[model samples]
Target chain A: MTRKRFVTLTLIPAIGLLATLALVSIAGAIWFSVMNRTLRSADYEFVGLHNFLRLLRDRRFFNALENSIIWEAITVIGTLTLAVLLAVLIFETVKKPLWRNLICFAFLVPVLLPRVAAAFIWRFLYSPSLGVINYLCGLVGIGPVEFLANPSLALISVAVVDIWQWGLFFTVILLKLLETLPREPIEAAKLDSARTWEIHAYVTLPMLKGPLISLTLVKAVESLRSFDLIFVMTGGGPGTATETLDLYAYQMGINMGGRISYASAMSVLLLIVTTMAFVIIWKAGKKWTN
Target chain B: MANITCKNIVKSYGAHPVIEGLNLEISDREFVVFLGPSGCGKSTMLRMIAGLEEVSAGHIAIGGTDVTDLPPGERGVAMVFQSYALYPHMTVADNITFGLRRQGNSRAEIAPRLKQVADLLGLTPFLERRPKNLSGGQQQRVAMARAMIKTPKVFLFDEPLSNLDAKLREKLRTEIRKIHMQLKTTTIFVTHDQLEAMTIADRIVLMRDGQIEQMGTPDEIFERPRSRFVADFIGTPAMNFVRAEIRAGDELCASGGGLTLTLSPHSFPDLVAGQKVELGLRPARMELCGQNSHNAIHGTVVLVENMGAEGQVITNVAGAEVSFVTKDFRSLSPGDPVTFSIAPDHIHVFDPETGRSLRKD
Candidate 1:
């Protein structure tokens, strides 16, 4: 056989499988939205753009979209910032290897636990009464505060749980990247009379830009589809304060209401949003890496 | 410029001792090269002097001030790492002026110093480019410029040219010497390459197994090595060692490998009859001679390595192999008869047991 035939034969199966899965799922979603379709209905009626029109008029859909944007912004920024700071502290500042390992392992415990379990654990911790958080607050003379029960604090509380569960992912990745950074530049910085903070600001942070951007992109994409933690913890309660796009889509199609066509439209919109986010982040990552 | 004094320095890792009870005084504006094999702790010694490594026990003083406990940043010294270590994110100009800026130098002061270093290192055009954008030699220039712009009391180089190619190493080696002459900073350079130490050093401190084997000027160290280790380490193809017994009579002589040599009266004055000694002859100092010459060792050529301007002729002297370099290479082939001669003044005698040179000089 010719080389080109052999190469084509070898690559066709893998590429075909992935392409088929992606095209079929996307095409099915678009088809269901364009046609009047329900989960239990036997009849399929063509209703062009009816579900999207209804989605445009839906206020709850806009609220969910806004909440999702807020959720992604908070979780991605908070996780990355806190992870970088903690990683630096554990890896650079803490010289003892034993202590570094112990601290890293402690942070990794939350990541190892399932997200639903983490949500439940945080739910108990954020309880107004009989929770350790309020007890600690009582010691500081602060009254019991409703964390998940209040509309203002509900989204933030859920975001905090997500941060707690997934922040270690960033920490582990960034820590590995930090370990591989060239030692000479840091030693040079030290000999150049840069103090600890100055070294981090000028040398360490600038060198970390590539990894930071890549990890930010990862975390942003991951948080966009976040559902399990919110589903377990808040359930979009307190007047939908913590309702995100993923949770609203699930609730519309499978939970409180059965609006599969409307849900398909929402999923298609989410797909577009995610694709745009990934493109923007990828461009930013390329610029920084260069 | 300032002198550096290391007194009874000791460095150990847990139970393993690296540098032990070492003492050396580097005069102001002196360029000293620490020459040794790998793991001799020469780099560690330089690091100790730069305050990058903590001295286990001893005092290191720069100029007249004791700086044993100070951090590297406070030690008033600059170092060029083997890897060059220019900040990849910063421009060449920023890398050169980073120390000055960190020390809170005004922009006016920093600009002139940066410009001076850039011009000196021929980095003026590439000042705006980052380290990754520059070539290896350009990055090395940035590293040197960074250290030079500081103008610290002492400069430390940890095998800075070992990473470069052979041609680049030679070029940079000469450039380093020129820079040293222009700045006259008390500099300590650590390298395992004896050639680098020989060409660039005002004084060569030869180290062996974490201790100072010998220290002297290049000529003194090369011509009058104090130990067998020094003689073997400081020369290419190394100095040849022949085990011989001293014959005492009206004139002293050493005989080994069926070859005999008469020793000068001033050489090994305390030698007794029938004492075992190792005789050292540098390959470059020994010369090819006609057969049956007086005071000559006869041998047959085993290998002739023609190195362009010079040739290394390895010959079998009795049962032992002896090699020498000669420029008069004309149709020399293996299995040909050859004779080599060494002057009495050029011979080095060492105690067989201790490897200590017995030659008084």
Candidate 2:
């Protein structure tokens, strides 16, 4: 085949995607202008950069922004720490490949489950009255405690569900990374009189830095976009305490009212934040690997 | 440095035997090599000695202590693997002093040990570099230095120089010999390369099919092999084998070939006249005896391999392919009928069926 034909075949998908993006951008610009016309010119208008000034005064927006940051922080640290710990433990302790594979399979079950289904499953388990957790706590003389029902505990509860459902994803990936590492150096370390803990600390841990950074980047972006699990578990309950940007956009655009333009604005903000996080992570990864 | 001994060592995987009831004794300060082909239990034997492989039915003693049940570290033997097995993440200094640090040695203790080993291996310049950043020979030195700094009872090398290029192999080969000489540490090196075994070993233990074929000094094994197998295994271009039979007139004749030579009847006086035998001649032993020379055979030269400084000439002798090496490269060419003879003392007679050398007691 000629080089031109090859180039056409490869570029066709990119061209198609760009065309769709251009058409969507055109329709969106027109719709945004129409929406801006109905509102007052001072508060919300097509006047360039006016809404950004109002956005600075928005309390709920700031609260959502703070919550998003806190959410990402907790998720990234929690997932990476737990995943690496679990992977290292299984790598050093598990001798049977079959048993290790089975454990990995069990971890992947949560990641494979539909997000809504997993959230609901966790919701039932955390239900205050007849939930197994409360019932078990009662055996230890503890009273019924609101997990997702309490406004103070709502975000934490949502994070717990996210960690439980997707922590396995990190565990499995990192576990494979650990298993594929050369065994000879570790053997040499053992011969070198390195204690079990020292082997993990000096040898295995340093080797795992690459995989850990990669998993952190992926799980951080994933946590920022997480919507289904939190929605099903808490519905931003009690005082919009667990109101993430994704839930806020859904609540405003679809559930509360047809504030499509407002939700779109929130979406553009989420997209920018996520894109910035990804670009930083990609750059860091490139620096590390290079 | 300490001596090591294996008593009735046996190892098997499931039902297949790898090391079958083997035994060996290594004296203190001796550089010993287990020379064999792949899958001949040489590495298995070394691993058992290092406590890396379980001895199925034997006891291992190091420095007069029974260590068959001990772990590798407690056995006080450090091993340099074929892959170097240097921790890629650690700098050269850290890799060398890892064992000392783990043994609860203070930085004061480890620092000097590291410095001494690094200096010994000429690795002081690369102390801060990681193993992956170093050349293969340097990495091998790092591995040796790591094992050395531990000051174990025995140093075990499992084909340590096999991964290097030919030039580096020779360079590291001499370096290893010099290190062994300086340290005077008891070492057991395992390799399939006969050249490495011959060049570096104080005593070479040749193994085949999970058994020791012969064990002796390099000179003894090379000049006087105990069996046809050892004769065939030790030399480069390998020893040539030609089947022969004792004829009615008590002459040695090349079997199925029209070649005849006088035999010293006293050499095999006990064997029947018609008994079959094999003659062993190293390539370097066979010389270009002149035409019409006594006990000489005329052979058509088949191929002339002119390596620098020497030549390996393959010839068709009495329908048998015989190879010989000569210092004079231009002395012979292919298709030339050349006469060659081997001295009676240079010739090894073997029982053709069992491949055992027939030594006169």
Candidate 3:
């Protein structure tokens, strides 16, 4: 068989299937964004650009957008710092395979827990009346701090659950990357008279930069559109203190307001942000790998 | 340049000892090769000398300064790893001068040294490239340049050429020898390839199981291997081994494998009557003789491997398969009758109980 025919015969179906699946989802989102479909009724009307036009004056939408940016910035930064520290600490200190694996598996428990289950677990842990966290704060003579109640602390409190789950997730991935990295360069650096911090700064961190950036971008996108944990924990709670774009959009479309087309416009904006993130990831990966 | 001396070095991991009672001294600007098979602890010794591995017991001195407790960097030694552990993100020039940078040399001071080593290794054009973009040989040259840029007092190489193809390995082996000559730094190279050790080392130290078996010039190692392991390991196609007994009658004779040879009593004074001994014969010393030749072993040819100029003929003599290289094997085939003769001076006799050569040099 000719090379082109052989390749086409083997590859066309998979590519076509993937393309169709992606097109259907994107087309569905675009179609829904312009239609006034609601959970209250099966009937819908085509309202071209009306949902997007309403968004220009929506204060709640702007609040959700700003909250999303803040939440993503906090979640991505917090998770990365904790994950890298955890990965490096366990990888460097725990020499015994059994102990290292146990530590890694323990940290990975949050990732394996269902998002709703984790949210509920943290909800109890954050309870002002009976929470272990407030109880600990009480031991330090501080009164019960309303973790998910105060307007200022609600977003950060809900975002902590994500940082917990995804921090360990990224930690496990970074640990594997650390393990797979060739160790000779570090040893060579030692023989080259590099001091401890200098070796880490010059050799080790530079080696880890590509994978670290990729993980950060991935975590950024994940936190930007995060919903289930916040929805379960605070339900965008305590006067919209933690109502990020994803949770607010979900509430508007399906649950409380039943404004499906307006929510779809917000979802389309999120999709645009995520798509831009993916492009940046792809381009960064290409640049670094080369 | 520094002369290195390792005195009664012992290295162990937990209860398992890898190197035991190892002692050696390398003179200033000498090129020495630690030649051994896998698990022989040749690399362990090299690492100990480099201060990468700590010795459980011993004193290692560099230029008469005790460096046993010193770190690798403070020992003033530079090593080229077998993996060519060049930084993937750094350009070749940056990688080469990293040591100088770490040593707190200013950028102006490092620039000329980097350029010199790059030119020396023919890596001038590749100085801007990352290691992954370069070929294997080029990467190794960059590794060499990295070590050379340090201008270290003692140089260490741990099987640096084993990662390359045959042609590249050969080319680098010559290049390494040339660099050693030009720089005149004390050098210790570890390798399992006997040919590589033979070609590049000023002195070859053959090791086995964490102990030095024999050490000498390459010619001495090839000509007068003190042990059967050394003989069997050093040559291509390996030396042929056979069991024999000393017949101390009117004239001392060694008899084995349906062949008997007269031995000079002065050479093997330790031989006694009815004593079993192991005999070693180099492939190049044996040749095919006429069918009715006197004092020859009669054997059937088993297989002939033809290599253009010389062929190796495996012969079965008294149920033992002996292989010897011969240029006259072109007409020979398996199952053919053959007679073989050995040069007397080249015969090697070892104590069967000790595996040590009985013949005195």
CA lDDT of every candidate: 0.89, 0.82, 0.88
lDDT of 3: 0.88
* Top candidate by TM-score: 1
Candidate 1 wrong stretches, greater than 4 Å: A1-17, A35-46, B290-292
Output the better candidate (1/2) by DockQ: 1
lDDT of 3 by residue, A135-212 (tens): 999999997999999999988988888999999888888888878888799889989999767776788778998788
Q: Judged by DockQ cut-offs, is candidate 3 incorrect, acceptable, medium or high?
A: medium
Scored by Cα lDDT, where does model 2 land? Answer: 0.82
Candidate 1 chain B TM?
0.98
Alpha carbon lDDT at A227, candidate 3: 84
Interface RMSD of each: 0.6, 0.9, 0.6
lDDT tens digits, residue span B118-141, model 2:
888899999999888899999999
Candidate 1, residue B325: Cα displacement in angstroms equals: 2.6
Per-residue lDDT over A13-132 for candidate 1, one digit per residue giving the tens place of the 0 to 100 score = 999999999999999889888887777777888899888899999999999999999999999989988887878776767877787677777878998898888988888988888889
1 or 2: which has the higher lDDT? 1
Better of 2 and 3 by lDDT: 3
Lowest summed lDDT window (length 10), candidate 3 chain A: A217-226
Total clashing residue pairs per candidate? 0, 0, 0
Cα deviation of A135, candidate 1, in Å: 1.5
Candidate 1 per-residue lDDT, tens place, B1-361, comes to 4899999999999999999999999999999999999999999999999887899999999998999999899889999999999888888888899999999999998888888888988999999998988888888999999999998999999999988999999999999999889988999999999999999999999999989999999999998899898999888978899999998678888998778988887867888998999999889988878676656989999999988899999999988999999997566799988888988888899998999999874
lDDT of 1: 0.89
lDDT of 3 at A58: 90
